[model samples]
Target chain A: MSINKDTVKYTAALGRIELSEKEIEHFTGQLDKILDYVHKLKKVDVSKLAPTSHVLEMKNVYRDDKVKPSLPVDEVMKNAPARERNLFKVGKIIE
Target chain B: MELNRLSAHELMGLLDKGDISHVDICNSIIDSIDKKDKSLNAIVNFDKGKVLERANAQKGLPVFIKDNICVKDELTTCSSNILKGFRPPYNATVIEKLLNRNAILMGKTNMDEFAFGSSTETSCYGTTKNPWDLERIPGGSSGGSAACVAADEAIWALGSDTGGSVRQPAGLCGVVGLKPTYGRVSRYGLIAFASSLDQIGTLTKDTEDAAILLKIISGHDPMDSTSVDRPVPDYAKLIKKDIKGLKLGIPKEYFIEGMDKEVKQSVLDAIKKLESLGAACENISLPHTEYAVAVYYLVATAEASSNLARFDGVQYGLRSSQAKGVIDMHKKTRGEGFGDEAKRRIILGAFALSSGYYDAYYLRALKVRTLIKKDFEDAFKKYDAIITPTSPTPAFKIGEKTEDPLTMYLCDIFTISANLAGIPGVSMPCGFTKSNLPVGLQILGKAFDEETILRIAYNYEQGTEWSKRKPGI
Candidate 1:
C-alpha cells in the first residue's frame, strides 16, 4: 500500500501531468493513507457475490440506428480554438 | 426584478403571472453577472444577446447549466482545457426539455475540468468561491452551479452528481441538491464521468424549487440509452410534510472514527427534529459502508479513463500542435488539456483496467460494489429512508486538501453509497460548524423513490431555520 516517490512520479507521468517535488511528496503521503483505508476490502468475504456493474436490472437500452442531420460543419467548427481546411487542427501526434 | 436573487420557483410564478417577461429576467441576470461575477468567476460563458432573444420569444425564467452539458452553438468545455473551445452540434436531451418548457438559458457555469475534482478550483477558468465565505471552496464539480444558486446569480441550475459532486457542494453552499435514481434523468448531454453513477440533478435554494425543476427535467429520453422508460411521476403534486409513523434508519457505520464532531452533532440534532415531526428513528447497519469509497474510486476512475479517451484532441476539444501524427496528437493533447486531478484519475483508471490487474482491481471492486448495494436494499426493506450526514466534515478551505487526494476522497464517504446503490438522495442545510461553515443532512431513499426523500427534506426544511443561515458574504 505504500506509494514511493518514484511510483508516484510514474503514475503522474502516465496521467500526463508533471507534479512538482512538493506535490509528489504530499500525494505520496496522501495516497498511502487512502490505500491503507481501502486495504480493508481485502478482508471482506465476497466469495459467492456477483460483481454488480449497473444497479438497474434492465439491459441493452439503445437508440435506434438511423441517419440524423448534423449541424452544419461550419457552425460546429466555429468554436474551435485551432482549425484548418474545415477540420479541427491540432498538434501533430507523430514525431 | 432582482433576477439574481429569485429562486426558479419564484421566477416561474412571475413568468406564469406575466409580472415580468423572460427577456427582462435574462437581462437582469446578465446584468447581475456583469455586476457580481468580477469577484466570483462562477459563470464560464454568457450569451446575453442570444439569451435575450430566446427569452423575448418565450418565458422569462433564467436557468444556469453546468458547463459539461452540451448546448448547440455554446462552448461545452466541461471546464477542461482539452475541450477549451469545443461546441456540440446538438443540444442535450435536458436542453431540449428546458427549451420545450420555454426556460431561458442564462449561461454555462464553471466546474472541475471533466467534472474531476471535489473542489471547483480544478476548473480551467478558476475556482468558484463559497458565497458565504469567499475564501473557501463552493463544494465542486458542481461548484459553480451551487455558488450561482447561493449567490442568486441564476434562478435555478442543473448539476451532475457522479459520487457526491452536486450534493456535497449544495450542502456546503447551504442549498437543496437532489441526486435522483440513476435512470430517472437522462445523461445524453452530460459529459460522462462514471456513466453508471452519474445522474443529472438540480441545485436550488429550497426543496420545492428542486421539486419543480426535477419535474420539468425528469423523463424518458430516447437519446440516452441508459435513461429509464418509467413514467415521470407528478413530483410537484406530492410535497407532503407529514412524516407521521414513517420509519427512518440511522446507519451506525456512517458515524466513523474520523468524522467531525460538530457535523455528527448537527446531524443528530436534525434527526431529532425529524422525530419531533412525527417520524420514528431507529439504528440500522450498512456494514459494507466502509468499502464505498474504495469501490467508488475503482469504478468511477475506470469509467472515466474510457470516457475521457475521446478527448484526445482529434475530432473535438483542445489539440496539441507539437506532435507529428495522429497518435502523438492524442497523447500530447490529452497531456496538455487535462488537469492534474483528471490525469491522476485517468492513469489510475487505466492501471485498474490493465490486463494483469483487471480481476484483482476492477472485478474485485465490482463485487464489493454489489455488497454495498445489497446493504442498502436489505436496510430499505425495514426502513423507508436512511439519514446520514451528507459529508463527514463541512467544506474545507481552498487548497486544504488539494495535494492530498485521500483527504479529498474521504470528504465523500457519507455520500458515495447512494451513487453505488443507484438510489435517490437529497442534501439539505441542517446546521453549521463553529467556523460558521454549513453542514448538510442526507436523506437517502429506496431506488427510484425520490419523492419520499424530497418530502422528508421539504418537511424538515420548513420546520428548521438552518436553511436561512447564509454565509457572511
Candidate 2:
C-alpha cells in the first residue's frame, strides 16, 4: 500500500503537475493514509453486487440531433490568450 | 434600501409593485459591493453597465451567480486560473430562467478552484472569509455565495452543490442552502465537478426566499439530457407549518466521537423543538455512514479527473507561455492553471480510475455508495425525513485542516449520503458553538420531496433564535 517517491513523481507527471520534493514526501504519507483507509473496501462481500455508477436509474436521455445556432467565432475567441485568423493558437502539436 | 439586507422574495415583491426599479437594485448592489467586498473577497467579477442595462426595463431585483455558471458574456472561471478570462458565449438554462423572470445579474461569486475544496481557501483569487468571524473560513466551494448572502451582499445567490459545496458552507456561514435532487435543477451552465452528483441550487437568508428561488429555476431543459422532466411543484403553497404526524429519524451514526459537543447538543435541542411542535423523533441506523467519506473521495475525484480533463489549454483558459508544442502547452497550462488541491485530486482521481486499480478503488466504492443510498431509502420508508448535524463541527480557522486531506474529507460525511441517494436536503442554523460559530441541522428527505424537508427546516427556524443572529462583520 506504500507509494514510493518515483510512483508519486510519475503520477504527478501524468496529471501534468510539478511537485516539489517536499510535496512528494508529504503526499506519499497522505496518499498512504487514504489508501489505507480505502483498503477496508476489500473486506466487503460485493461479489453478488453490481457496481452502481449513477444514483438515478435513467440512461441515454439525449436531445435531438439537430443543428442550432452557435456563438460567432469572434465572440468565442475573445477570451483566448493567443489566437490567429479565427483559430485558437497553441504551440505546434508535433515537431 | 440597502440592497444586501432584502431577501429575494422581498425584492421581487418590491419590483413587482414598482416600488424599487431594477436599475436601482443593481446600483445599490454594485455600491454595496464597492464598499464591503474589500475585506470579504466574496465577488470575483462585476459587470455594472451590463447588469444595469439588463435591469433597466423590467423588475428591480439583483441576483448573484457562482463563478462556475456560464452567463453569456460574463466571465466563468470556476475560480481557477485555467479559465481565468474565459467567457462562455451561451447562457445556461438557469440564467435564462432568471433573465426571463426579470432578475438582474449582479456578479459572480468566488469558489474553490474547480470546486475542488470544502473550504473556499483553495480558490485561485483567495479565500472568502466567513462574514460571522473575519479569521474563519467560509464553508465552500460555494463559500462566496454563502458568505455574500450571510453578509447581505446580494438578495439571493445561485451555487452548485457537488458533495455539499453549497449546503456545508451554508451551514457554516448561517444561511439557507439547498442541494436539490441531482436532476431537480438544470445543469446546462454549471461547470462540471462530479457530473452525476452536481446540481445548481440556491443559497438565501430564509426558507421562503429559497422556496421562491427554487420555483423560478427548477424544471426540465432540452439542452441538459439529465434534467428531470418532472412537473415543477408550487413550492410556496406547500410551505405549511404542520409537522404533527411527521416522523423524523435521527441517524445514530452521525454522532461520532470527534464531533464538537456543542454542535451535538444544538442538534439534540433542535430535535426537541421539532418534538414539541408535534413531530416524532426516533433513533435510526444508517450502518454504512462510517464509509461515506472514503466513498465520496473515490467517486467524486474519479469523475472530477475525467471532467477536468476537458480544460487542457487548447480549448479555453489560461495557456502557459513556456509551451514549445501542443502537448507542452497542455501540460504547462494545466500545471499553472490548477491550484494545489485541484492538482492533488486530479492525480489521486487518476490513480483511482487507472486500468490496474479500477476494480479495487472505483468499482468497490460504487458498491459502497449503493449501500449508503440503501441505508437512506430504508430509513425514509420508515420515517418522513432524516436529521443530522450538517457538519461534525462549525467553521474552522482558515488554515486548520489544510494540511490534512483525510480530515478535510471527513467534513462532508453527513451531507454526502444525501448526494449518494440523489435526495433533497437543506442546512439551517440551529445554534452557535461555545466559540460563537454557528452550528447547522441537516434535514434530508426522499428524492424530489423538497417541500417536506423545507417545511421541517422552516418550522425549526421559526421556533429558534439562531437564524436571527448575524455575524457582527
| Top lDDT prediction, candidate number | 2
**Model 1 stretches astray by more than 4 angstroms:** A1-36, A62-95, B1-3
Give me the displacement of residue B350 in model 1, in angstroms. Answer: 0.6
Q: What's the DockQ of model 1?
A: 0.45
Worst 10 contiguous positions by lDDT, candidate 2 chain B: B52-61
Per model, how much of the real contact set is kept? 0.55, 0.60
| Candidate 2's TM-score | 0.96
Instruction: State which candidate has the highest DockQ.
Output: 2
lDDT of 2 at B466: 81
lDDT string for model 2 (B107-181, tens) is 899999888888998898999999988899998889999998898788889999888988999999999999899
